[model samples]
Target: MQASTLAALKELALQCARSAGELSLKRMKEPFTVEYKTSASDLVTAVDKEVEKHVISMILKRFPDHGILGEESTFAQDPAQFETLWVIDPIDGTTNYVHQQINFSVSIAVYHKGEGLVGVVYDPSRDELFYAVKGEGAYLNDRPLHLDRIVSLEEALLCTSVFWNKRAEQMGIDLIVKKLAGKVRGMRLLGSAALEMAYVAAGRLDGYVSLSLNAWDFGAGRILVEEAGGRVTTMTGTPLPYNEKSSVMACNPTFYEELQQYLHVAENTQTD
Candidate 1:
């Protein structure tokens, strides 16, 4: 890992995320135009585009050679063409932001040579910032977060998203949820994968698993979880590739193995 590059990216990413999140909070109560993407449940707002544009412009100005992948914008450099890439989700949980004005986050992760080097996720409303550098411990607003104590699945508090409106994958998630619901203390659906992962890193939640996420959704959170003494992998117990589109299963280190076993059982039953 490039320690110096990671440090630099972490500093810049925190700055940009804070600025973008502040912009979002400032306009939260104001009237804004909303648009639909693919379906009514999938949403985007004027603020989402505005924040993404602002962040992209700032990143490009400072690091002209770096490639950017943003939720609301097109990539400037092809994924195959660059060794360093910035994955950005300017406003995660747009639906919650539009209705509740909370739970949204600005996520940024920098990958160097296909490995995550730095990550930052900022929740502007709460002024909560979670960040990590590869080989360095994760932090929540300067306080270090450790996941060493959370070891049991039964004692764990979990979070996951149900694609309730999307029928194709609903059965799979439902079965998983049914198996887990009574075992854990409680389960939450936060509507933002990035924030849920951040919470896991911070020890607020013990684990998270969800399907159909793109690179931008969990890129930052994955690094945070790993740095905070957690493990991140595909739901099928595979290593997460930088560019693949799949489900994410992240949790504290001690519970990951056990959770993987349960996931294997679920998959087997599905196939059987």
Candidate 2:
């Protein structure tokens, strides 16, 4: 895509993210209805749907030809076949939003084929807006962001999550964490994939080990990490899959392969 077009899209994404985030944040301070999607721990709120609708309307109005692949609703645009496709997670950490009233975020990414063209992850709690466009550097609000220098597993601070709805998946991820916890500087479970990835991009975390995330969950943060000089890929070290749930290890290239080796083993051992 042309630089101008990409910039426009970035601006559009930023606006939509900020709008959605503001909507959620405003409603967050008030009482709202919650419902379970897969499990009691796996949740969604009325605000999640409301904010998604707002975001969808904004995108459709501005770029109707564009296709949408959102968490709350599915649209008919094939990203692989179209010039532009938006993958959105209006509430990337609904549990956090519902429980703590913080740590959640609004995430959006526009892609062509499988390549990210524009990405935005907004944390309304902190008023932090992280965004990047293809060929452009990553940003944390107004400042440029970059990952930390390479560190060994022992010195690295790694992040991971346990799936609330999938016990076997949690067992696998928990086992990996149990094995690695003593080796890393520390481990963190922030409850928000987008925030965790933003932390990786900003050098707050050395790496992230994710299992069973949908395209909407990590799409925006993937490009942000890459543009900040980190790498995001599947457990086997290939590029992220566009239209599926997959495991990911996102960090700088230095220890990616080594990290993936362990994740690959964990994936195999963790079964339903």
Q: Name the top lDDT candidate.
A: 1
User: Judged by lDDT against the true structure, how good is candidate 1?
Assistant: 0.85
What C-alpha lDDT, on a 0 to 100 scale, does residue 265 get in candidate 2? 65
Once all C-alphas are superposed, what RMSD does model 2 give against the true structure?
Answer: 2.4
Candidate 1 residue lDDT tens string, 141-225: 9999899894698988998874362531544656666678788888888888999999999999999987568888999999999
Between which residue pairs do clashes occur in model 1? none
Give lDDT: candidate 1, residue 46: 93
TM-score of 1: 0.93
lDDT (Cα, tens digit) per residue for candidate 2, span 1-272: 77777878998999999999989989987889999998788898899998988998999998888888888874545555556789999999999998888899999999986778888999999999999887787999969987658677778888887534365345566666567777778888899998899888888888997666888888888999999989898765667876667777788667776777766766555431
**Could you give the C-alpha RMSD of every candidate to the true structure, in order shown?**
2.3, 2.4
lDDT, candidate 1, residue 213? 81
